[model samples]
Target: MDSFPLGVAPHSAVTIRFVEALPDPSPVIAEIIGGGRSPGRADRYCAGPWGLTVVVGLAADATPAQAAKAGALAAAALIGEAIEEAVCAIALSTEASVAFARAFRARLFRPLSLKRAPRAEDLCRLGALTLVAAKPKDAARAWAPWQAIAEGTEWARSLCAEPGNRLNPTTFARILGGLGDLGVEVEVLDAAAMAREGLNLHLAVGRGSATPPCVVVLRWRGGENDAAPSLLVGKGITFDAGGICLKRAAHMEDMRGDMAGAAAVAGAIRALALLKSPVNVTAVLALAENMPGSRAQRPGDVWLGHAGKTVEVIDTDAEGRLVLADALSWGCATQKPRQVAALSTLTYAIMAALGSHYAGLFATDDNLASALLSSGEASGDRLWRMPFTPADDPALKSEIADLRNCPPVGPPDAMNAAGFLRVFVPEDIPFAHLDIAAMTLKAEADDTLPAGPTGFGVACLVLWLMAKG
Candidate 1:
């Protein structure tokens, strides 16, 4: 009777009646609530992985402080149990937001695993330990581990939610620059410099925007070895108005999320550095705003990529792959990373295929694909490998350039985009592309995770890098 009980099934509702007196509580509160006792609320409820519900009373004369403390303890009990299953959602209560935040952080103090749920003993042991503080709208205690996760998630949401004007390339660079304190060496390369390095594709995609383009790179050298690092290239279009081939206004505001892949990369670097993981990682973020002004590259244009290969512009909306092409070519040619992988919110086909839950991964190497598959599943940021083959390669063919950056036509737009990117990869080097259009944001919030900005790829990358370490 003293232990907390979980609802029988997922998201099943259980009501607890707490009043000044146990006897008075049932009839009076029940009349106001008009509900029968839920099946698992009684003292004799099952006690295996889940135990009986604990009922604590806050007297009618209780101060807000006392109620807050009771609420924190109650919330902690619920959240701690969720840590067992590695997932849970909390419906916010007006009076308990602060208390819930406090309790949520408390759950992480125990041997909680980000990779997955903890064992029963660890979960039970954690459920019993309590910080037990009286709370009245006090700021929640800064739980370092949870706070880092939270900051990255919240950062993603904020960046994604902002209007395009509020978050252009300069501001994007500033955002990366801000993370320097977290040990990421941030560098912002302007259009002139990118031009000097022959980043024509990046410059071509960005020319129409008045915002001026910039490429931000974040480097983290945490590993002991001075080996060639694994590179993560992100396609960062700060806002894609679709250039001369303008996107419909229906959901254009969501274009702010076009940079989400970059955000994921930055957030991953931030988390790795915050956790002080021993892995050397570098992120090449190509930041630009794709608009349809007179100066923008037209449909027939052909831009030279970093590897000195030309890419024909079949569609201006296929801009993400353009920026990523330059970034990948640059990262591979200069950085010479042992393995190169890039992430992007590139194509709508991925959204149609995987819905809004998973990322589409394209890899030339089966081992990298398998490793990412395992890491992604373990971290809750799942990725499904879509095909990138010789069969699909012809779909991206062009007469003017070495290859086109988009498919002429297909239901498998995601695959073609990946196929387009394959042209930039060196024959001997291994590469992968993550189409994260669907996985970057979530519709609702959860206890261990915030709602809007899921920071989907961050956890998977961290887990992968740690495994390498």
Candidate 2:
């Protein structure tokens, strides 16, 4: 759990400038484009001869959101593969300029590299980028919150990107323990400890994995009073081999990202702690590794969860909900939180329905759901609320068990998975389930993000927490 520097600290690898309009093109840019004029809004140009590459042009009519996204796009164009020193020139208001710079720095950030051998050019890199505002002094204050959010997001992405061998359930717990430095109280519940408390469903899911399963509880008490904290439960399947219902060979390699939800929870808490937000929050990360072995839970097996609810396992591949059920129930019953929100890459149905553009959100409380939606929009971690009705519950009913992990026949499978988890959440508490199957990773580099873990929920959760404050 090596600590990486937070945000894009001032250095010499990259340079970014925000302006109302593009500056005069560099001689090299001019030569490359045959002495053409500067680029228009949302356009960029690279000048290698000037020892710099720059992204130019931001539309005058662009909204603050668009400007932020443009800034990310610009920065993404220059990180890693491109020249280390880069500039972002935009013509906008001081506030908009600050917003652009914040986003540019966030997108330009790279997580700690685990590469054992690296090129000499990449060794001892000290690249830094600057954000020049129309009013530099005023804009300086505006970058703080965004910088904190970026640090948290990058931290989560680094954890998610770590190899399974390096970041198992035990190592994950150890890594989160680092947050104790920020006043976050960290607790780890091992397999025997959880079993003693009747967390059968959660433990059963990881029975086959040598890495074992655990529950990580991170408590951040920054509020004034002892009111109930907001409880966040994350599914931390460090690696998913699909158990006995093994997945096809096509993209099984990506299973390492199954723990992305836990990473998001950790990231959100880190951001809140770094910002010193006056909100009490508890994050319950249900960590496990779903692998195929003689000890693995088989299909049709039934296990009682922490809440004394029985879940019949219909498909071993749908193991996230099993782990989350125990965490949600345990968090609610023990912590007595005012609200509960669970994040997980729980269902492929979500990806099939919403694609990579949005996460599927299912909530029992309208206000909480609305707040999350608003946060998602503002944070660029978009969520589409999926329909959930009493009608969807019938699919989860089982003849022997209280509920089935996956119904042989159901309303869209994602909703069924949500329905299964809903049974674990107490009716009196507000609960929201975020199925981020499509939001975890990208197939290709986009304007604002690289082709890897996106750290989608960190900013959204932080914004929601801030709004609550």
Question: What TM-score, over all chains together, does every model reach?
Answer: 0.71, 0.89
Best by TM-score: 2
In model 1, residue pairs whose N, Cα or C atoms come closer than 3 Å (at least 3 residues apart or on different chains), thus clashing, are none
Question: By summed lDDT, which 10 consecutive residues of candidate 2 come out lowest?
Answer: 5-14
lDDT of 1 by residue, 1-469 (tens): 1222211111211212111112122333333234443321211112222233333344434444444455444444454353332111122232343333333433233211222454542343222222222331232332333345544544554566555766788877886897799888888889889999889999999989988988898888888666878899988898999999899999687787899888878877887788787788889999999999889999989888888988888789889989988898888887778887798898878988888768899999888888888989865579998887674467777887788877666564787788878878886777888898887655454334333445568767767776863
Candidate 2, clashing residue pairs?
Answer: 12-128, 13-127, 13-128, 19-90, 19-91, 20-91, 20-92, 21-91
Q: What is the per-residue lDDT of model 2 for residues 353-408, given as tens digits with 9 covering 90 to 100?
A: 89988999999999999999999998889999997647446777888998888877
Candidate 2 segments whose C-alpha is farther than 4 A from its true place: 1-34, 37-55, 59-62, 80-91, 112-114, 119-126, 389-392, 409-412
Give the lDDT of residue 377 in candidate 2: 90
